[model samples]
Target chain A: MTDDIAVLGAGMHPWGKWGRRFVEYGVTAARSALSDAQLGWNDVQLVVGADTVRGGYPGHVAGAAFAQALGWQGARVTSVYAACASGAQAINTARAQILAGMADVALVVGADAAPKGFFAPAGGDRPDDPDWLRFRVLGATNPVYFGLYARRRMALYGDTPDDFAQVKVKNAAAGRANPHARYRKAVTAEEVAASPVVADPLRLLDICATSDGAAALVLSSMSFARRHGVDPVRIRAVSTVTPRYPRTTLDLPDFATDSAAVVAPPAIGFRASIAAAAYAEAGTGPADLDLAEVYDLSTALELEWYEDVGLCPAGEGVKLLREGATALGGRIPVNPSGGLASFGEAVPAQAISQVCELTWQLRGQAGGRQVAGARCGLSVNQGLFGHGSAVIAVR
Target chain B: MRTPVVAGWFNADDDPDGFRLLGTRCRMCGSVFFPRADAYCRNPSCAGSELDEVPLSRTGTVWSYTDGRYRPPAPYPGTPDAPWEPYTVVAVELAAERMVVLGQAAPGVTVADLAVGMAVEVVPGVLHQDAERTWTTWHWRPVGGPV
Candidate 1:
């Protein structure tokens, strides 16, 4: 459990629709990270790229593609895809390599040029694929699932639409201070109520948008960090666990959940298990975390994450939000970098971006959105299908 | 002629009891799966490969519901010329199987008409129609509502 990797540098290209290739964004972020680490591209011995399905043939082999874009320095390359958890997996792969003594210095990168409107599955008729079948058969877009969760919250926890809108208001205020954020203007609750409904019980403003963005990290072995004369923030743990069988809760891209007729469901849900695994490995719990960056795909989902991350008991996420415990400068600030609400979703780049925010905060480098005296931070997100990821970083 | 959007999902032919959603139950462990787990039992503890086809519960309580206010992207087989109409989707918790199944609500049942824990029953309905065939799919209607 002592195999922690040092984060020497972190960087991101400002997230937005630049109408450019994802490789360009990735290269910019990588160059920035290399410069921040004071190491040239040739100095790194390994590189990992998070794959994006939208990026044609080169995207399929993103590791070699980004390496080629960075002028091919003969670095060992690997590409990984785990839907939205692609970035965390890429980071985990690098951490594994560094801890195993296979590499001294490694770079991890994830970038995406998202499609306009609701994200649909790759084309063609395939009834076997659940991702495709959900859209084709039920017309259940991603927002549909978000709306379902929101409504379920309202029913079970007495959460109101106004409570959901308050999440947008708070995150937008934080986004205004983040130069890297796409939407920098603070939003009013009225605006959220006025926004057209994309799915019932959730307005367009409640949901995160699709965008093109990139994030990168330069990681090194602890010994390498000490020799390089850098006091680096270290990644204590990366949890990339899958859901246990008979997953009771309904997740995205699935028509139905696994039946629990024969066996009882797990005591803790899949989302909770993600953070629990990370905390166990890091030897820290929710109380030890100074801040967190969770995937806020929708305003309601943000409230859900408050509970999922164990900031509060189940069905009491809204109470935490109401008490301002999750806002910036609160008891434990969540998503000080504006989260997906302001940054939108860059998919593969998002989980890495969360870690980047943590790194900057832990190092006291976050200009305006800094959480005061942040010592430890955790980033949690779940990908499409069963990929659940959580990473804890300590200064 | 009538056709199913996806074959073997549910019963399409007319029946008085209405169409029941089809699934598979593990013969060894008694675990049930929807969309038909033809290959193997998904339970981690059970190594049962003999899955038998079975009909799912017709009536269940609504776990949650939502409406799609936007036109979903392609592979959904929507006609561009026609005006888009929002439809309500419901996730119903089948008590017997101890699982939640999601499906479109019966035509004319808006989000206003649905609530969590309301009783709903599965029934066969038309999804869309082409010149040759009328694509059939399952719809969830509140039990004791208009047939």
Candidate 2:
């Protein structure tokens, strides 16, 4: 496509509980990206950061935080927060700047030093804030939603718990080869079953943990990429869409869904729309995708993404799984980066990390977990409060 | 007397007929909100400014159900110093409002006891009891269960 931004470089400060300030991880990832792009920090014209709410004040202004940590160049800085979609928004902001002829080169960074255990909302008796209210009133944690989804799938599609465990097994196997992943050990279904249940139908291993990590990308205008004398993976489209009103499905941190009484529900659900928009913008379809890196916050959710991303029809995600279509060396491997199953979740950096995996796979650089002859790949994730995120990259 | 954990969420009356989860409905578009949107209607197509408080349907079908097997972190008011107890949660689809409302299942209900499409009804229940006050909230119970 003519409208494209070259991913000149991609890097990460591996996913784990490092316990350092989020800024430190951002700077390390940013420097690695700069090195990968064969450019210096001084060469970056713009810096875009995806914010982490847990990092206190500095995380709120993450763009400048990373800039300051990298010794302060006079780069135009922007910070964005969209919950888990923060990284995609950061990347989108940088791409817009580059495309607007405002900057030839832009750096995008996202990092997080997440808290341990079930993520809680900002403290307070704020009944008006749905995130806080859900906790205070319902005691509903993130895994609760995952459990509901998993159980619903089981009842509707006859998907057994064993089907869910296989997803963890496949992803962990992929993660074992990924040096940046937090958990390097391969998991078996027995191990997943043995883990204690955090929420009914979902065990500790089935759900992703909170982690500390960061990811960075060096992006530039296609013309700039040519001038730099490097052929690179290019972002064909970035989709950030909100659900159409009357959103009936229950999402995270919400007490209730938008009533579909007034208007008929949208033809496509919110999660499905994320990737549909990207495909529409790229003038491509699911068949054009060589691989995908979807947010597998829970192993069952990964199966949902298989349908949401149009790899299979609705209710057939488990069937696709049974056929081994989503596993590595199968048709259209998904979560070849181990996904949240192995890496846990560093919210702000996650979407960017997905794109980082896509960049590596598309460029034929993903050593052991590479999708052979991969050319086009997409990454999809949804953040709280109706933030939809998806990116399509091609080489 | 029971104090609501969050006032205006549901009626704290012990009478079964009087207990109903309170929400607001848009007069313009007939849309409903559980955490009651009194300010404006959320329907994008309608610019309804007036949302009237309405008692949601007392009975609904189970959309989905799960349980918190671990004690949730702070702000949940989990009992201090006591061992954690798993509690069931359910998402019930009110046919009248055509929206799903989430709440804790009636005391003692487990994940094994619930199923999708099973009929459930709202009931007044206690969330937690402080030294001076009993914090009240809504709970969903199977339609035929004890009141």
Candidate 3:
């Protein structure tokens, strides 16, 4: 197991269509995190920013951009872009820097000001880009892939539309209590059903919307935390894993899965392997987790995460949800912070926001949506391309 | 004038099986890659570089299906001036290759006409048309259905 990095502070700019720049949101979140940590911008020796493509050239160099916005103290900087997994990877970078004795305190931030409607690839005729190829050739939007997964669940697991609606209902109820969530109103199963269909087998509410949001964290070495006289929540592990070749399950931005003809498929699926690696590094099993925050880009995807995280056996995610095992007051609450169902998506910021929620829950600071006596929490998200990340944190 | 949306992905030859998807097979490991793997073998265990062009199976079973109820963004060739027409998409699983390939369903095939595990076959179809050229692409059609 790797040494733990202290989560000294966590903060965010409330998610919404704020119509502002991503850099502004990120700087705001960074300031809030710095305040919470009782540290100044100059105190941070390293800064990592999760990049957003929509921000143009400056966004590609997000770490330096945020540093300049925060009145550059000439901190060492790095930027990472792993699609949806960007935030987790940024956190992983900060953790590695602290563990390697490269820095005593590190600032990690991710923010996005998304465009309206469906996300499209960058302009130009790049045939080699899978994101462009899918849209150009197949007209396959992201929801189409989500719809595929939802339909597959119905056929394989007997999960009904009502079952899917329950996920939105549960998450929306929790979202109402989160001040940072964009959609705070409680959503009913009826509302979900009433929502227009964006993709077959999944309605508009089943899929998350793109929005403007930002989340930031201040991570420090254990010695720094001790010197500051702060007992901080610790990040135990950050598992950033890529898919093994011959992945059978169809994923986003891909017209086809790799063939298994040449090699045998891995015993553990990609998503499952993501969580397993985190659990292995954290020296804890799913049973030890008091709460979890997962990438619920779609309601049905959340159910898949239950099985992927080993909360229950495969194909029994619906059964566990039906029994209220994953609800806010359940034995092991999942997404008590309302998940992406509440926050929608801010791309680079979403995964970091997951960790922010976990940090709050672990610190017993999650107001009404709190998982009672939460001690250990997990955050799992998969990015476009083959990136998958799972982080474990403990108080 | 007419053109394939992306060339070399589908057969242009007049074969009896109609149009089949083209992919590359690793000579050493026998791994088949669609959208054609012209480079090195993707299999992590193999370093073999020899790849042979081969036509994939024309028939596969429906693994999952969905419909694009809303218009997609740019690069999709959906005319901005035209009213959006929803199209059904199918992910077909080839048993021999043990891979799931995604493609647009034949025109007029809606979600109502599809079910998981149903038999489907690949057929060439038009994606969109400009003043000069028609973009051709592969579409999945349910077997024994009206086309």
User: Cα deviation of A346 in candidate 3 (Å)?
Assistant: 0.5
By TM-score, the candidates rank as 1, 3, 2
Q: Cα lDDT of all candidates, in order?
A: 0.92, 0.91, 0.92
Least accurate stretch of 10 residues (summed lDDT) in model 3 chain A?
A52-61
Which sections of candidate 3 miss by over 4 Å? A56-60, B13-16
Please, what are the lDDT tens digits per residue for candidate 1 over residues A168-221?
A: 999999999998899999999999999999988999999999999999999999
- Which stretches of model 1 miss by more than 4 angstroms? A56-60, B16-18
lDDT of 3 by residue, A140-215 (tens): 9999999999999999999998899999999998999999999999999999999999998999999999999999
Checking candidate 1 for backbone clashes, the offending pairs are none
* Residue A129 accuracy (lDDT) in model 3: 93
lDDT of 2 by residue, A1-395 (tens): 33999999999999999878899999889999999999999999999989888763643588888888898879999999999999999999999899999999999999999988889988767877888888888889999999999999998898988999999999999999899999999899999999998888999999999999999999999999999999999999999999888888899888888888778999999999999999999999999998999999999999999999999999999888889888899999999999999899999999999999999999888999999999999999998988979999998
lDDT of 3 by residue, B5-45 (tens): 99899976345357899999999989999979888988898
Return the DockQ of model 3.
0.90
Better candidate number, 2 or 3, judged by lDDT: 3
DockQ per model, Cα: 0.90, 0.86, 0.90
Docking class of 1: high
CAPRI-wise, candidate 3 is high
